[model samples]
Target chain A: MATTKTPSRLVLNGLLNENPIFRLALSMCPAVGISTTVMNGLMLGTAVLFVQVCSSCTIAAIKNYIHPRIRIPTYTLTIATWVTVIDLVLSAYAPEAYKAMGIFIKLIVAFAIITMRLEVFACKNTVAMSFWDGLGMGLGFMFGMVTLGFIRELLGMGTLLGHNVLGFRPLLFFALPLAGFFCVGFMMAIFNYVELVFNRRKKRRG
Target chain B: MARLRRITYLTLGFLLLAYLLVFSGCAGSQNRFIKKTSFRGTHSILITFAGPVDEEWATKASNYRVYEKPDPDIVLKISTIELSTNRQTVILHFEEPLNQNQPHMVTMRGIMTEGKSVGTAIVKVRKLYLGYLFSILIGAMLVQNFVFTKYLGLCVFFGTSQKRSTAVGMGVTFTIVIVASAMMSWFLYQFFLKPFHLDFLQIIVFIGLVSLSVQAVDTILRKVNPMLFKAFGVYLVLVIANCIILAVPLILADNEYNAAESLMLALGAGLGFLIALFLMSSVRERLELANVPPTYRGLPIAFVVAGLFALAFLGFSGMSIF
Candidate 1:
């Protein structure tokens, strides 16, 4: 295999091509759970970003030494360590978010994306590269989560981050998990459309 | 040699990390542990009746310091007993006291049990464990159900129900994921989240763990049996981010359930999810040939059907089988 250095591609793949919520569709627990409000989604996204990036970096650094037989347990141990630290800090300081997030926060330890990065990307890449990749993927997931949150919060409650943007009767169903299905469907359609447009324009220019 | 070195290094690294995590986690919370003794607070209730106290029953109850007064001014007695159903009723008895115009204080307590007790004697009342289990089973199946109330885990519920054969496979796949995820979450919460004081990180941790486990399983399945992976690939991936698997542990942790109860809950929830999926998929297959409106074809009609199911399930809320 030839060695390749392509940082931007890694970031782009995560942001759009393999977006966590839309494309790869990993990490939907908090995406659906907290997308009730823009602020809830934003804070949750940030927390996930921090954990994902940190865990990816550590996993990359130790990838070579991790045996195939025990790679999972090792990754879990590391992820658990970071999650515990974050959990403690949150309960002590931000108790409200902790309560609101409830088990979804704890559930993150089992999220497929963190392990997928370890097995697929971090295992092969340098630590620095892994960090960037993690950041991009984490942020991509956050973007989808927050966008879903914004739409649901705005339509369901006539507000954005609790601030009233328009005076209209709320579509209460938009706040529910079923709404997540509708939101993801529409978002994926838009993503598909944008990609189609961008490709067609590029082809014309070429 | 390379494999051995990797295994040894990885093992050491994991052990060291776990130790550091536990140590730092406990250190952060100086007032974490609180000791409790057995004899903290003990008390017994006494009941007085208008008639002579039942000697044999009173004698047995005296061990617990519980007693009966034959000439008491006030008391509560067991009025009705339904042993088969574990239901009982008590009546209050009050009489004019000897203080002429003053009212007297009397207390009567009924101790009910299924098995013979070393303490006070009373009518037999079947244990609540069975009752609790019945309620839990019913609750898991219908009321506060995985499908209707929580709205969790609809992805697999809908995705797996397209064909009967696919539904069975999906159900089995879901059950496995549920059991594995629940056990994993339970252990992680008890050992890591609680002890280490890293509770704030629960959402990320749970999601991360489930995601990783699913990924690992997918990898192993793909490598070992390409045919099996091909058959269940899409549905298996859907199960990874399923809300039910993640949500059950949250509910379990919130309720402060024991290990047994958590496992029961996981099983009940997995079964509940399977039930919903089977029902919806069968209906969809029939709907495929029906003359349907163009606008309300796929998802919208399914939502309406699900809403009706939810409404039907609401009838089971007040039922108490135990």
Candidate 2:
């Protein structure tokens, strides 16, 4: 699979086809939980991106040594260790963001997307490929989270990353968990629709 | 092959033994049963039990003795020992007002529950407001719902909600697993982690316990009732990865809730998930027949409906139930 796919394709796959939150619908917990504000979403996404890349790179490097029978636990321990390290660092250095995102950060250890990447791509791929895959997937997650965060923040609070955008009272519902579903759903629809039209135009011209 | 099987069995047996030893060792410690003491008011301090105490044993005034520490002369007599309806909380009424500045030692000797002795427990009273438990419940259910509010288990939330039957099954399973795991995790956190100052390891420990219990439940269900297991087995396995199961304990620990409050929060959160799933599934069933654009079909439409539902649920906010 890695042989056929170019590095750019892999990156694009992560950002588009296999986008963890929007396309594959993985890790929606943090996406909804922390995406009430753009800052919260960005911070949580950064944490996940860091953990995902580190875990991917490490798993790729050590895939040969891991026993098949115990691979799941080993992978889980790896994610947990990285999450813990990030948790400690965030709490010590970025105390305010840590206060807002502490619980969500701890939850990164159990995200299926991270484990899925390790099992599906990282374990079998080269270290360099795995790094790219990780980066793409992580960036994809960050993009989805930030998008959701941006929408929710804009609608709910009439603000974007703490700046007052709208002068009136916001919908307020967009800030809630229920609206997260709506925002993602509509965004997904628009995304697919545009892709469809884009493909149609390309086909007609060709 | 036989040797390998033997080795596997031996390893499994050793792991079980170690788990038992650690759990029993933690339970054996006096600190396990006695949680913390808090001032409910000027005259009373609420002593929380880690688990439900025997109502009969708890009601008996002679079982509990409170003394102002370092001052035997200031013996505070128990006026009334009120066991909460949940059976986890025991509100001790004292004749003499507790001094806010001084500390009090509560001793429960041989508190028997369900034909077994819980042994002795001694805890120092600390300043904790009891009024927040209600807010925690409302907040967990309505304000910070695991599904609609926090988005803990969206995979299951969206995956099972297409069919009403599956949604209900998932809801029941989720409620049971979440509440049970929350209680178990609380016990593990309080008795094991708190005593050892291993609080930082909570995330790993809580997730491990949740996954292990889910596995245990799956196996036991398969053995005892194959039909029920067959219906919910796949969903149960999927639940191990469900964020809500892990989130309950994490939220409970983050908020520093006692056993009773943790149970309530768990129940509330689970109920919230159940309500959200049921609503979404029912709406989707209707949505299936509705004419829609190609792009807005299926999950995208379901999400839009869910957003509307979320908007409806937002009405529950700002409600001062307490």
Identify the candidate with maximal lDDT: 2
Model 2 Cα lDDT, one tens digit per residue, A1-206: 63667778888899998899878888877775677889988898889989999999999999999999668667878888788889988999999999987578888877889988999998998899899899889989999999989889898989988889897646977766566777788888988898789999999999
lDDT string, candidate 1, B162-204, tens digits: 7866775566556656766776888898988989987666655
Query: What level of docking quality does candidate 1 show?
Result: incorrect
What does candidate 1's lDDT look like per residue over A1-206, in tens digits?
Answer: 23544777777878888898766656654554567787778777877788889989998888888889867667766776777777777778999988887666665665667767777888788898998899888888888888999899888888887777887737977866546555665665566667678888999999
DockQ for candidate 1, C-alpha atoms: 0.11
Q: Compute the lDDT of residue A91 as modeled in candidate 2.
A: 93
- Predicted model with the maximum DockQ: 2
lDDT of 2 at B168: 72
User: Which ten-residue region of model 2 chain B has the weakest summed lDDT?
Assistant: B21-30
Question: Model 2: per-residue lDDT, tens digit, B1-322?
Answer: 3433443454355335434533443322236777656778778878777777888898998887788777957668888878898787888888877775455777888977666997787776644323344566567777766676566787778888988877876776677677778889999998999899999898778877777777777776677657666776888867866888877888777767666667668777877887888888898898888998999987788777866766666677666443
